[model samples]
Target: MPTTEPGRRRRPRASTVIVGALLTVGALVTAFPFLWMLFASVKPRGESVAYPPHLIPSEPTFEFFAQLFNELDFGRYLVNTLAIVAICMLGLLLMAAAGYGFAKFTFPGRDALFFLVLATMMIPGQVTMIPSFLIINGLNLTNTLIGISLPMLVSGFAVFLFRQFMATIPTEVLEAARMDGAGEWRIFFSIVLPMSGPILAVQVVLTFIAGWNSFLWPLIIANDQKLYTLSVGVSLLNQQIATNPSLQMAASTLMVVPILIVFVVFQRYVVQGFTLSGLK
Candidate 1:
């Protein structure tokens, strides 16, 4: 058996303790706003902003929630957001598959085309915003869910992540599948896709979150109040907060809860994707 120095063992133990403390602090900082929002949302309308700012309400009430549902068009906003996210996810999946094919397979001008696509990511989104709006307007999609989802349907980030992941797949596996008379689509769907569990999970979580939180594009395209996304809806709630603080908190609380749930469920995949992508 190899003998370990006491000093070396202590170094690792000390490192572990430091990491744990940092993580605990980080978690508390991130969670504080969410905790505050939840507590505030349940408090009585006037008490939510009472002097001294109670962390926990002495008397909790659902009046805010009831007001939000009855007076605000929150339900319509939620449905619009859900529809746009669903469409964006479907389109992003297709784009990811195309990027994977281009990265992992051979074709004429594939590298040139992908590089061209990648080059566009270097351009600021603001620069293209007007042109994109014009195109959507020409298509008569503005003020619709399709318009809200259009800008996000094909993401350069998603393509980049998918391509990087697919590049790591073994060439031998692809060749073997080809020799077994598997078609290109079949190989992608059956063999390569089955082996891409980690990347797919990462893509799904990232894309879903992006679609869920998208604000600017949706704001520009969805001129109708009925088509507002969660972020835009929350911003509108901020406008009403002065008069209906409790209801505003309830709306904000509602907007954040779904995102929190998604993060908790897919945090592992989110971490893995970020780590792996960073390495590349």
Candidate 2:
């Protein structure tokens, strides 16, 4: 009998090719503005505004960035941003503990209480701003980092995400720990938290991004020029020097870089966290 010829290599399906092409186009479109900013920040002022909008710097310079840091007092703003972001991280830990309590512990009116927590999320931040401002001011926290950070400490969304994720922990684990004479706090801090790495990373990235982008609360609360976060500072800068593309682009880059780094560092865990938590 004649030997059978080897099968020819299979080609990618037309649907796969089309889907990949569409996705590539979508990614380019999404990234175009960021790529533009990164380029424009380094470009000569005239070149930043030239026809066709340069995506690559012809004569890269750090002049605008220098102005931002040296002349514009952005160093103080940066320090303020970092300090607030750090406090937000601390708030996340507290939220995680609360989430653990909600997830594992049985209590009276548990569902109703949790519902109330979720209800708070429905109220827009704008509506609450005036009240929050008054309360902070009454407490003598206005124009202080503490006042700016009070709103960052905990959120209904954080609790919900943590509770959802923590629910996946087995009841047997907690019971066994209790049988071994471990305290509730010990079980939570040691076992539950260590096991919650993915969701923690997810929440961390979310919280940091939110804190970094927080403009309204900080703007209203922080009357002191020393306490301006990047968003508030850059916005004011925009008002004063709206004509300078390079400075604006540099400020935009400053606002975005931290968020990008954070997401990149935690990107893998984010999807995993959502999947484990049964979130869509």
Candidate 3:
């Protein structure tokens, strides 16, 4: 056993302290924009862009938020975004099931098929945008929430994430379940999925953020004002209230809140999922 000299104590190195300070500074810098936005969101309209900007609002009010909800129909946009998120989350579960199949099943050409699926990730989304639009047009889904959400139903990244995470499961446990005569679906839904909470939380947070923040595809598909998601609706609100920085900030704050809440809640699971997946 290693022993320290009597009356001697170890202390963190100077380099460690310096690194800690630097990291603290970095975190503060990263968080500044969000702090600024929150403060600005409550400020009176004229004070938002005043010279020598203040970090704290002098006269805070909820008038801008009221305007955002009442004049801009932001409530409707929130409902549309929530509906789309629900649909996309169901699709993500299907994607996870497919990933579980890829991870656990032994099939001919399985490796080749998975490789092909991963290869799709390398293709830029822009390349398929026009073709996807044409297909949606053909289906007469234009201006519909379903059309806006169709392209986001599945993606190579989500499949790959679930596959990697699922690969970490112990095969012996699955074999034991098989010995008990459990059907494949029963084993998967009851045994496998319940044990995959971390990765599932990771997927939920990621898919929610993506679905909430989706702008371009939604804009292209849902030309109808009533069908606009929060992202599109906020952009139009910004355009109409271009001169009102307070209102813009208020709208932006609303847009950011859901994603922030999701991250704060599931960040631990995200870290655990990534760590376990990397080990696999």
Candidate 4:
């Protein structure tokens, strides 16, 4: 047994202290932009671009947000964003099921199929945009929220991510469940899914962030102002209110804050998923 002597103080190594200080500085630097966005969002129009920029606002108000939601019809765009995000989440369920099959089932050409999927990830999305648009336009889905979400329904990365995480599960446990007469669906839903909380949370947060931050595809698919997502709308600030840094900060804040909250809620599970999945 290791025992500390009475009245002895154990100090951290100098290297440990130095590393901690460096990491703290790095984190502060990384967070500075977000902090500035939050502070600037609440500041009056004049303070947003004030010289010798103030870290804290002198007079904080919610007028920018009010203008955004009330005068500018930002709420419609926010609703569109939520709708698109929800549709994307529904698609994630299907992708996760595909991942489960890829990870667990042994079928002819399975490896080849998965390899093809992974290879697709390397291809630039720009190459496929025109073809995808033609297909969607052929289906008469242009200028609709569903059109915006249609292309995002399939993601090779999502399949790969969930496959890796699910592969870490013990095969023996699944076999035992089968011996007890559980069907494939039963085992997947009742056993596999319950134990896959960490990975599922990870995927959910990833999908939310990707779907929320997505700009180009949504812009290409939907032309109606009512169907424009927050990301798509925020990007048009150059043409609408290009000079107002305050409104820009306010819009950016709305876009980023939800993602931060989602990440915070799932942070523990996300870390756990990565740590455990790597062990396999």
Number of the top candidate by TM-score?
Answer: 2
> Per-residue lDDT of 1-280 in model 4, one digit per residue for the tens?
9888999988899999999999999999999999999999999988888898898999999898998898777899998889888998998778878889999999999999999989989989989999999999999999988888888887898788779888988999999999999999999889888888887888889889878988898878877777788987787776876578888899999999999999999999999987866645
Tens-digit per-residue lDDT, 42-83, candidate 2: 888899878987688889999999999998999999999989
Predict model 3's lDDT versus the native. Answer: 0.89
> RMSD to native for every prediction?
3.6, 2.4, 2.6, 2.1
TM-score of each: 0.87, 0.94, 0.91, 0.92
For each candidate, the alpha-carbon lDDT, in order, equals 0.80, 0.90, 0.89, 0.88
TM-score of candidate 4 on Cα atoms, chains taken together:
0.92
Worst 10 residues of 2 by lDDT: 2-11
**Winner on lDDT (1 vs 3):** 3
Name the best candidate (by lDDT): 2
Pairs with steric clashes in candidate 2 = none
Q: State, as a TM-score between 0 and 1, how close model 1 is to the true structure.
A: 0.87
- Sorted by lDDT, highest first, which candidate order results? 2, 3, 4, 1
Give a tens-digit lDDT track for model 1, residues 79-158.
88788879877875587687677778789999898898899789898898999999999999999888878887887767
In model 3, the runs with Cα more than 4 Å from the true position are 1-16
Q: Which sections of candidate 4 miss by over 4 Å?
A: 1-8
